[model samples]
Target: MTAQLEATQVASTQLDKNTIRRRIAWRVAQEMNDGDIVNLGIGLPTLVANEVDKDVELLLQAENGLLGIDSLALEQQIDLDLVNAGGQHIIAIEGACYFNSADSFAIIRGGHVDATVLGALQVDKYGNLANWIIPGKMVPGMGGAMDLVVGAKRVIVAMEHTVKGKPKLLQKCTLPLTATGQVDLIITEIGVFNITQQGMELTELAPEFSIEEVQMATEADLIISPHLITMPTPH
Candidate 1:
């Protein structure tokens, strides 16, 4: 391929990946109810904040002590002290509050958070989450994920369906568990899965992908929902 064509392909590939991430974020944002106190975990979960409707009255909590995360701040507009748990600079909305880590943990551990969106390294058929570490690889220690998953009334995992073309949805998680049997729902680039008493149920699929594709990529046995539908593209 010509250099120009190669460059265009690279850009297109990056855009596709970003579109998938935004789609997952948008779907996760829709799960939030009005007046819900939601926590956005680091990485992909943080993208949900950008997709959230401004009219939705969500109290966005950051474990590092901010309580009302808005949109991403521009370089010149960023406040060094106003960063989220992931250390990303953010804009705070009106009625935002700040407290120490103790108070933040208090809110999370007390079950005051209505819902939490987290990114998972792997999710099993049983809905177990493994996000904190990869065995033998250097990783930042598990910070507040354990507390959020356990304390939030609802837990939604937003992640890619696969990592480097390998399935992330498996019969059992090979990595260390961040929280066991805690995930309620999972939103990925290709589909949505609901963790039910029976097992992981595929409820929605991206328009571009086929059920067979999803099945082939998922290592776990996926129960197809009778009402399975194609997920709408984000506006």
Candidate 2:
């Protein structure tokens, strides 16, 4: 691709290796149908708000106590009382509502959300997700991950292809798990993989990355999509 087209793609759909993490979150948001109730975990999952259509009727649920939340914009001043689970500033739409954090988790545990997007630290070939504190190492708590993973109708993981330059997807996770066999799909900078009972199937790879390249990156065996297609470059 020409430099100009590359720049256009980055500006339009925000698709590129540098933004791959965000693109995964964006793709997860795009998967939502009208009226779908969705939960977004902290970190990369928070970026989904920027990619969704403003009029799609999708309700955003935050573990901290907000629903139907809107994206924070620089054009608008910050609202101290409105924040997401990560404690980041967020805006609320006209029909948005707030509840207690415990109640918010209850909503998730009750399977009220159609889907959830979360960041993963490590995902095994069997769909097991590990995102909590790595024992003996500095790490954050699981927060609401356990509830969301098992309760959501579907769980999508948005994360980088690697952590500290090592592949995050592997045959097994080295850290304590957030949830067991709950992840449905993983979208990463290298590719999109579907975790099924059989194995990790590669559905799509980043435009500049090849299947061999992705396989070399991960420790687990990869199953390429029979209907594999390259990602569309942004206009």
Give all candidate RMSDs, comma-separated: 5.1, 5.7
The top-ranked prediction according to lDDT is: 1
TM-score of 2: 0.88
lDDT of 2 by residue, 41-108 (tens): 88888888877877788888998888887775444668777788898888788879888988888888
* Candidate 1 lDDT tens digits, 1-235: 1432333333335448878788889999889889999999998899888888878888899999989889777899899888999999999998899999999999999999999999999999898999999989998799999999999999999987776656788899999999899999999877899999999999998776667767777888899999999887687
Give the 10-residue window scoring lowest on summed lDDT in candidate 2. Answer: 1-10
Predict model 2's lDDT versus the native: 0.79
Worst-scoring 10-residue span by lDDT in model 1: 1-10
Tell me how far the alpha carbon of residue 122 in candidate 2 is from the true structure, in angstroms, after superposition.
0.2
lDDT of 2 at 69: 78
